[model samples]
Target chain A: MMRNMQRPMDAMGRDELRLWIQQLQFTMRDLALYLDTHPEDANAHRCYLDALQRWKQALAAYKERFGIQFQEQVCDHTDWSAWVSTPWPWEKGEN
Target chain B: MWQYQKALQYPVKIKQPNAKLAKMVITQLGGPDGELGASMRYLNQRYTMPLRELSGLLTDIGTEELSHMEIVSALVYQLTKGLTPEQLEAQGFAPYFVDHTTGIYPVAASGVPFSAEVFQSTGDAIADLHEDLGAEQKARKTYDNILRLADDPDVRDVIRFLRAREIVHYQRFGEGMRLLQDKLAASSPWPKNPYAFNPSFDHECWKHKGRKEK
Candidate 1:
């Protein structure tokens, strides 16, 4: 389950890469709810940690390729236009 | 304290723009049992929870509902994108289009604006958790109604995801209720009368310091 993080980012298309990140996020979120009630479940805790690590890596790679998703991610030299110029999520073909 | 994540929790890539469908789907974003109410109900109710675990559960579920709100907004936005005034009117979206003009507004399908009156934060542990459980089922039923009417696969796919989440949340809230009940039972003078006092307001039950006995 963890090996996907080792796969080369370039191997997947933009949409595929985004989908991968979304899947990792879903895993983390679902695990989070389970852990909230069953905080003593060690197996779920491990899975949450694994998902968190993969989600972070995949998100970083996505930002590097597709520009920043959040304003704080703006680089010192990078213009703010880069953030506004990208298509909003609701726009067709942007997701 | 929350930072924005400029992405949908789930991907919504609706290919067709249908004003008619947008009208109905917008309800989940603003209707009485909508995502907006779901988020507010849990977040507001968390403050007075007697158990730490219950508070944590409310916070998590509340945050997820915010994400769900974004998803529903994206669906409405995508559905209404690029629709002409004539097209909108033909599809009975004119009432919304007149006031908001394709801009997303929180309103029921009947064009009633969103209101806080839809939910409650009674500050009682058992009551609030029961409300949450019912709220989840109501939201789930709304999604089911949407699925029954929605013909577009793209729209139904996203609706199904949101509906499934409601069921999961319902299950979690039920567990949270059990947790609260167990704590109350342990501390109650009479286990059968746990409802005799609100655990949230009766801080003495939990033995918090800095309070003078009356």
Candidate 2:
């Protein structure tokens, strides 16, 4: 089962990727919504900071388990090809 | 400081998948105006942004696109499961099976793997913002197409959610773009960042000490 897991940036076997993404997604969503209503909420602002930190941690874990990767290149040249050199998104063990 | 609500983080709880719908969504996955490109464009473009709110918007929205990719994959996985060869040939999924074998891939709906040329970071604020606007519209249209093409109620529900999110993202980016355009006339207080995501001026508390550029 572990052998089958091969996708990068998604962190195989942890199942943390999906849940973490969902959590952060929800965090930002609610933050956006509430901040809309209560722009002055100091607590919400602090939460945003914490949420962003959590988000970075999730990104780090994903990068650590899989490798640093990007969805697209800003530089026209793939001169920084190393970023895209890893496995593709559909490879097994990546879910 | 961005406080978060746990419930809204990953509100999509189901793991439903539909093949035809998946195919259309893949257009946004690997297609020119797809989610992958949008995500990449915004995430990478943030470094050069002059505003805090706009940068935050890009980071959050770009990150959400990653989930959109996963949602499509989940749908594809559910749709392609337990298929027979005959079904494969009839449904036009055979060629893909040969390449990926029921796997979720970052390919165009036509079956090509993702390409790096999908997104751009020109470093010019007006150009990138225009691109962001167009990108959101393209994604919205793709979702609209998915809504038209998908027959399954399950798939339609998710498509509706996805479609709505695109509109929201468009509004967010549009607002951020306007904010930048207005700020351009003033002296560059936060550096001439074309990718800054904050449309709101509340970055004083949310920004990190080390990460703050100015």
lDDT on C-alpha atoms for all candidate structures: 0.85, 0.62
Candidate 2 Cα misplacement greater than 4 A, ranges:
A1-27, A33-95, B1-18, B188-214
Model 1: per-residue Cα lDDT over B38-153, one tens digit each: 99999999999988889989998999999999899999999998888999999999888878998889999988999999999998988899899999999999999999999999
> After superposition, which runs of candidate 1 have C-alpha atoms over 4 Å from their true positions?
A1-8, A64-66, A70-81, B204-214
What's each prediction's TM-score?
Answer: 0.91, 0.61
lDDT of 2 by residue, A1-95 (tens): 21233244344444556456545646666477445434578988888777777666666675556544433221444524645564443333332
- Write the residue-wise lDDT of candidate 2 on B93-195 in tens digits: 7777787777667888877778878778865556677888888888888788777777777667767877887787777777776666555523334445523
Q: What's the lDDT for candidate 1?
A: 0.85
- C-alpha lDDT of residue A90 in model 2: 38
B73: Cα error in model 1, Å: 1.0
Q: By summed lDDT, which 10 consecutive residues of candidate 1 chain A come out lowest? A: A70-79
- Is model 2 an incorrect, acceptable, medium or high docking prediction? incorrect
**lDDT per residue, candidate 1, A16-47, as tens digits?**
88778778877888888888899999999999
